[model samples]
Target: MIGMAMRGEADIAIGPITRTAARLNVVDFLTPFQEEGIGFVMKKIDSPLLEQMFHVFRPISLVCWVAVVVSTVLTGIILTILAKLSPSAEHKEASLSRNLWIALSSILGQEDCPRPTFHQGYIILGFWWIFITLIMALYASSLAAFLTVPLPNAPLRNLEELASQTHYKPLVTQGTNLFHLFKSAKGGLHKRIWEMMSDMPKITVMDEAFSLVETGKYAFISDSSELRFELRNKCDELEIAQDSFLLTQLSFVVQKNFPFKDAFDHQ
Candidate 1:
């Protein structure tokens, strides 16, 4: 459409055609009717079922879990060994099973287990309590964050992030101004993304690009209004990014010295 207007083959082209400095050389655009920016259309991200189920345990590292288990066993063994060495009948009655129960219960924040009676038992139990207190505090502090925080499906929020990721394929219409916008952009995120897209297959149609976006692997960069319209009417799974890199004012394209330029601008 822009080509037709530029070549003077069409008197006027009515649509959301961006008016850039380069285009102004060949064609005149009426006062902008719509203002928008170039943004990506992506698929809505869904949290995984497995992640949701295990969210409670995600706060602590795997090494921490192993450490906790090892500490529990060691504390129980220490208690049992100390009890055997004690001469008192009450201390000697602390069997391996009883010591293990005490250790497990203390670690689990339970108070039902009997307290250690011997002096050595007291020292070992005191150290075990300190360790348990620290571990409990760490787990409690991180647990709330893991359980309540919502993880976004697409972690890429801006062009730089989108460009950095290989899993996300950002696309643009083959012949549109957006294609040229990136193609001519110099030495920045725009050029980087343009180079990335250059190696991949070209997307000629918005609908085709949108279909790929529905799969959640591809991102389509295009006019915000058009993308939003399609998102509302066709694909519910698609979403628009909050940040737009290229701001453009859209107007009807008319050939230079066209008779209706004045009338169109006045209206």
Candidate 2:
């Protein structure tokens, strides 16, 4: 369409024509009718509640769990030894079962356990309390963050992430403006992403590209507007990435010397 306008073979080229630096040199564009950006379309993420529930324990390492258990048992033993060495009969006769119960209760957040009677017992309990406090604090903060945030199926939120992953094929139409934009991108993240896309197989049709994305093995990089429109009516399984890059203005294209260019711009 842009070629037709540039060659003066067509009076105007409408539809979703992107106004790019390359196109601007040959053809004049009217005021942008729609603002759009390039983004990825992929299957919607569905993280199971059961999986999330299991993730609660992920913050604490297996080693940490083992350490906590060993510490609890050792603290109980220390309390029992302290009680045996105490001058008071009640402290001297403290049973191992009672000492272990108190240690377990304190670690589990239960405050019903009796206070340590001896100074040595108090010191052991104080150290155990500090350990429990730190462990609980870390677990609570990690679990809260995991449960409150929505987990995405694909972790590719931006072009950099998309380029980094090897699981999904990130694609663009071979001869479209988007392909050219990426191809001509000078250096930096855009250039790296362009290389990644170039390595992957290209799909010629938009529908075909979207269909592949719906299967969850591919991510289609294209116009946000078209992707949203198709997602609303055709592909419920598909979702667009939240972050968009390479914003392009959609406008009508006309010959460089077209007489009514200003008129079109005014409207």
lDDT of 1 by residue, 1-267 (tens): 878987888889999889889899988999999888888878877669997787677789989999998988888888888788787528444688788888899987786778788788888888899999999899998987766785555557788888998887888888888888789988888889988886656778778898788777888888888888888875546668778777889999999888989998998
lDDT of 1: 0.82
Q: Write the per-residue lDDT of candidate 2 for residues 180-266, one digit (tens) a residue.
A: 777888998768778777566667988888778877788888898888887887544667888998787999889998999898888
* Model 2's TM-score against the true structure: 0.72
Clashes of each: 0, 0
Cα TM-score per model:
0.75, 0.72
Please list the C-alpha lDDT of all candidates, in the order they appear: 0.82, 0.81
What is residue 70's positional error in candidate 1, in angstroms?
A: 2.7
Tell me, by lDDT, which candidate is best.
Answer: 1
